[model samples]
Target: MNAQREKLRMMLTSAIFAAIIGILAQVTIPLPLVPITGQTLAVGLAATILGSKYGALSALLYMLLGAVGVPVFSGMSGGMGIIVGPTGGFIVSFIISAFVIGWYIEATKATVTHAFIANVIGMFINLFMGTAWLKVAASLSWPEAFAAGFLPFLIGGVIKALLSAWLGIEIRKRLASARLLPYSSSKRTA
Candidate 1:
């Protein structure tokens, strides 16, 4: 009974985070190639707060929702067309970023410093994947792709990483204190 409840809780939390990501996706800066969106920050927060399993689940759920034409993506867009679009790599990389961030937090500690490190790493991963995808999808040269996809977002990415680290750590601490979050580590099988 307890295990079932826990599973349900985790799933619910993941769904909530997925919704949160979708909502944040609407907050966009509207860049040329790929608009700057709050999705990455949401992804960082989900990973920092929920840890590896649920964090990845949230990203996957968000992607799946958008892929199914749910308009859960940035600019209220959705469908398989978006998933295969120029910015799709960044969206796809969210799952990898969230999992890596959450796994790092679970393995180490969920402190702001650790979270920032993990978030930075995740940001780089996002930029790299997105840039590569942009190059191929848009048929641009490496320099052009970096200019449009990677370089433009570097400072913003750092800022978002810092914000996600600070806010996420604080929120996670509160959730843990309220007993809403599970263990800090991934050792809790139940």
Candidate 2:
């Protein structure tokens, strides 16, 4: 009974995080090729708080929602069109980023420092994948892709990573202490 309850709780939490990612995705700053959004920050938070399995589940849920014309993507857009569009790589990278970030946290301590390091790695993953996709989808050269899809977001990525790290760790700590969330090791089992 207890195990079933825990599983349910985890699933519920992941769903909540997926909704959060959608909400944050709307907070966008438009650029020529790709816009900066809070979606990555929410991904970091989900990974740091939920660990790998649930974190990845949350990202997958978010992507599935957006893919199905749920208007859960940036600027309230969705559908398969966005999935095949130029920015699709970044969206796809979210699943990978959440998994990797959570895996790192699970392998190490869920401290702010570790979370920040993981988030930085995830940020790079997002940028690299997004840039490559933009190049192919937009039919641009490497320089153009980097200029439009990568360079403009570096500073913002760092800032979002820092924020996610600090906030995620803090929230995780509190939730764990309250028994609302499991701490580091328990998350592995959960």
Candidate 3:
């Protein structure tokens, strides 16, 4: 019964985080390749707080919502067409980012510094995916894609990483204080 309840709680948390990601998409800075959105922060936070499984699930749900015409995507665009569009790679990268960040957090026992590093790793994944997709879908050369798709977001990514790391630390502290997470023996010893 307790396990079932815990599972339900995790699911609810995941959905909430997914909704937050959607909300973040509404906050955007227009650019050439892909608009800057708060979605990255939400993605980082989701992974850092929920760990890989649930984190990926949340991002998947967010993508599904957009694919199904929920207007949860950036600029309020949605539907399956967007998933196959030029910027689709970055959109798809959200899942990968969540998985990478969450996995790193779990592997490193969720230290703040490690979480920041993990976020940077995740950002790189986003850049790679986004730029590659831009190259293929938009028929741009590597340099052009990199210039248009990745360059504009560099500083913003760093800022997001720092902010998300702080957010992750705060979330971890709250979850620990609330006794909401399963205690790790390794973490206890550390």
Ten contiguous residues minimizing lDDT sum, candidate 2: 181-190
lDDT of 2 at 84: 88
Q: lDDT per residue, candidate 2, 48-96, as tens digits?
A: 8888899999999999999999999999999998988999999999999
Ranked candidates, highest TM-score first: 1, 2, 3
lDDT of 1 by residue, 117-171 (tens): 9999999999999999999999999999999999989999999999999998988
Model 1's TM-score against the true structure: 0.96
* Model 3 error, position 33 (Å): 2.4
Q: How many pairs of residues collide in model 2?
A: 0
Prediction 1 global C-alpha lDDT: 0.91
lDDT of 3 by residue, 144-184 (tens): 99998899988999899888877876786678668775454
After aligning candidate 1 to the native by TM-score, how far in Å is the CA of 154 from where it should be? Answer: 0.7
Q: How many pairs collide in each candidate, listed in order?
A: 0, 0, 0
Model 2: per-residue Cα lDDT at residue 174 = 77
lDDT of each: 0.91, 0.90, 0.86
* Cα distance off (Å), candidate 3, residue 175: 1.9
Please give the TM-score that candidate 2 achieves against the real structure.
0.95
Clashing pairs in 3: none
Q: Compute each candidate's TM-score over C-alphas.
A: 0.96, 0.95, 0.94
Cα distance off (Å), candidate 1, residue 21:
0.5
- 2 or 3, greater by lDDT: 2
